[model samples]
Target: MAEEKAAENTAAQAAPQVQMRVLGQFIRDMSFENVMAQKGVSGDVQPEIAVQVNLDAKKRSAEHQYEVAIKLNLKSKAKGLEDILFLCEIDYCGLFHVEGVAEDQLHPFLLIECPRMLFPFLRRIVSDITRDGGYPPVNLDNIDFVALYRNELMRRQAEAQKTEA
Candidate 1:
């Protein structure tokens, strides 16, 4: 019995206990506008589209819970036309249970992995909203969170260097 108990404890220690789960998802804020609805849908005009994405995370409680938010802003306008075609902004958030992540790894896991997990649902909401607003679905491309994180780090470094100089 002593040997068995020792073996079990050893196995438990050797195995990394990591758990990540999405507890809930919600749209904190959403806005959709079709500014030129009166002008009607113009098939010939190819509008310019701009999209921006940002991620933020915060600790919800002491029990290894986190809330991650993904913000998406989209704007569309015709090249020559003065009126805007459409605008969409959404702040989508997810409550997550994260455990067994090292302190150094926590930032990346929250920013990259948590957002990656929530992205598909957020994308779907954007698409559906756009389509319902009388425009074609604005399909969002898959985000490269790793690249984004690196770029953010570089930007911060540049800013720090500028301040020091």
Candidate 2:
């Protein structure tokens, strides 16, 4: 029993530990435009709103620290009118510390896990900004980080193939 306990302790000590922590979060930039606010447009006209989201990550230091940024661009325009109703752009970033993750898994971890951690705050900011800008709150849908990452990978692969061709 003592030998078995010692073996288990040794195995536990030899196992690598993984840890992820958010150090800080901030808005890198924000822009809002109410293009038709002064035009006195009727409330009956509903505009089509388009939202785009992009993610980026960079290593902050030689250590396992990284900065992940989520960029959101939103534009709303009346269905048949060329005039835009409102536009919003926001860049939200988070500082993350990841330790003991394998080198091969690090890229996905940063792109997927870090953004997943920061998305709720980004969503809230978008909602608040749109509401405060005189329109209904823009509640962003939940993001699928894994799907995004996979799509990005496929895009890059296609680009590489195109270059080779």
lDDT for each candidate structure: 0.90, 0.92
TM-score for each model:
0.85, 0.88
Q: Please give, for residues 56-153, the per-residue lDDT of candidate 1 as tens digits.
A: 99998659999999999998998877668998999999999998888899998999999999999998998899899887788899999998888888
- Candidate 2, residues 1-102, lDDT tens digits: the string is 999999999998887798999999999999999888877775765778898889999999658889999999999998897878989999999999999888
lDDT of 1: 0.90
TM-score of 2: 0.88
Q: Against the true structure, whose lDDT is highest?
A: 2
